[model samples]
Target: MNKKLSYNVAIVGATGAVGKQIIRLLEERDFPIQQLKLLASKRSKGTIVEFKGKDLVVEEATPESFEGVDIALFSAGGKTSRSLAKIAVAKGAIVIDNTNAFRMDEDVPLIVPEVNMEEAKNHKGVISNPNCSTIQMVTALKPLYDRYGIERIIVSTYQAVSGAGNQAINELIVQTKQILDGKEVTKEILPVSSLPKKHQIAFNAIPQIDVFEDNGFTLEEMKMVRETKKIFGDPSIQVTATCVRLPIIYGHSESVYVELKEEYDLKEVRELLMNAPGVVVIDDPANQEYPLATDSAGKLDVFVGRLRRDLDHPRALNMWIVSDNLLKGAAWNAVQIAEHLIRNDYNESK
Candidate 1:
């Protein structure tokens, strides 16, 4: 454990949006890699992806694909992770899954490195990355939660179209041009692509993300609610969310309101966030300074601003949070976990 070691790494869904970002970060971060494997579905086989100025051909992902991989990063989708994560773990690879497949599993540690790095040490073969929205929210809230106990949370998200994948980004561009040219817009994706109804994402906001459940909450909203409790290891904390998809293309923004168990001073709350790791505060409202999605795009840190106490509630405070959904939300968060494991020589079987 003392000597520097390079790992044989594999990335599942290497051709997708988040997967591509993961590759870029691994190279940019200069992660120790003895060998790298690019994996995708059968349709993406034989595709070429560039890494370290060399072309790496992507292969179809099978159980055997992970035979010698020391770390497997899964970002394809929940279905792919559900089927392949166990196989990767069986082959002695530590699986850091970005999909929701195992986030709620009791044995799987849902990790946001800045929030709860200790939970990762107890993983029994698999660790999960939180949802893009949840990751940024929790990252901003952790300092406050530790200082003043949180009683309840209510959040509304202004998420980017990129969260839906590369296809949704294309749809937004195509639809926008069509509208400008006075041509009929074609809608094939957005809100929910698989569902019968499709909404225009060009200059519009859709109130739904993922499919709606019996409780009138979309799957995405429920993920924020459930994942927050698990990440904090505090089931008593009440959380609610309304996730919305916006026309932007990179960062996800949230308006978060939290009721603290203890009274807090506004100045001290801002000071607490200013010193927190992985959080950047920009709350100078008079100068028109605040965290914007445009400013946070491609950035690794979660941006927090517009800090204030709620007028109607004595113990409640409000803030705005933003981060790159593709980076900190998905790829960067996953890479952070891998780095932590290697740094600590984490035992997957523990």
Candidate 2:
């Protein structure tokens, strides 16, 4: 868009789980990159990461790091993004933030490329990626929303351990081993790390993800409720979610119930999802085919299955959706927004 052959890219939080995936995707997708810079916290400084067969040292991110950057992909925590995202934008870089810090901000566009990419065109230098669970749900529902008009949405998520980062992944493995060895299982990082209490995520399901608000819904649940309306640009659509943490290591799966405004034929609904972009329908029940976290791990597409009509509510439908929490949910979605900007020549007039 700048009339250059390629752009200079920077990945903040380059040493973390989602950040590492962003690096891999950028390379695997062969994104046009003139220069790739890796930035992380002081603790991660001097760490070496590879890109395109070359080693790149992770640097301590500071205000000066944005100097020559053209596109900055931020997977750092919300606090870091709150502190640095604007500075990067002021330095003439488009920021695709994979954090909750700016998603609901009136000026910042909340984007899931397959769903509401047009909102991204109005970005005032920074665009926000939705929560991991929200991304995959909206992607699979977009086609149906367009055809049948979604009236109400109720979702329950079985999220992976990796959504909490590498530390939580380690905790799950440690606890699993300890329990098997008859040692006291350690509990430290599940549910919420900052809280005084922690729970074992191995061989168990924690009915909470993120802290709960006064309304009794967890932060993760509220994100799906709020972000879905914004992405669909429909406030009248009712949405509620119950997010749960599971022992799985990679994919996040959801059991979703949707009430539509108009009646829908089951065959047409399946056909619509089959034709949707970034969606894979695996609803063959006769052969025991369906979306599974084990099958969806490492994949970029959102896998959907178990589609059926609700018995009591004739206009209602139910289904299951799955995707790699780190890939399609975070890194890949952020990267797709960047690619969309390039393909559409966004901000070229400037």
List lDDT for all candidates, in order: 0.93, 0.93
Clashing pairs in 1: none
Q: What is the TM-score of each predicted model, taking all chains together?
A: 0.98, 0.98
Per-residue error (Å), model 2, residue 8? 0.7
Candidate 2's error at 74, in angstroms?
0.5
**What is the C-alpha lDDT profile of model 2 across 184-272, one tens digit per residue?**
98888887998888988999999989998999999999999999999898998899899999999999999999999999999999999
Segments of candidate 2 deviating more than 4 angstroms: 348-350
Candidate 2, residue 338: the lDDT equals 90
TM-score of candidate 2 against the unseen true structure:
0.98
- Candidate 2 backbone overlaps, count: 0
lDDT of 1 by residue, 51-86 (tens): 999999999999999998889999999999999999
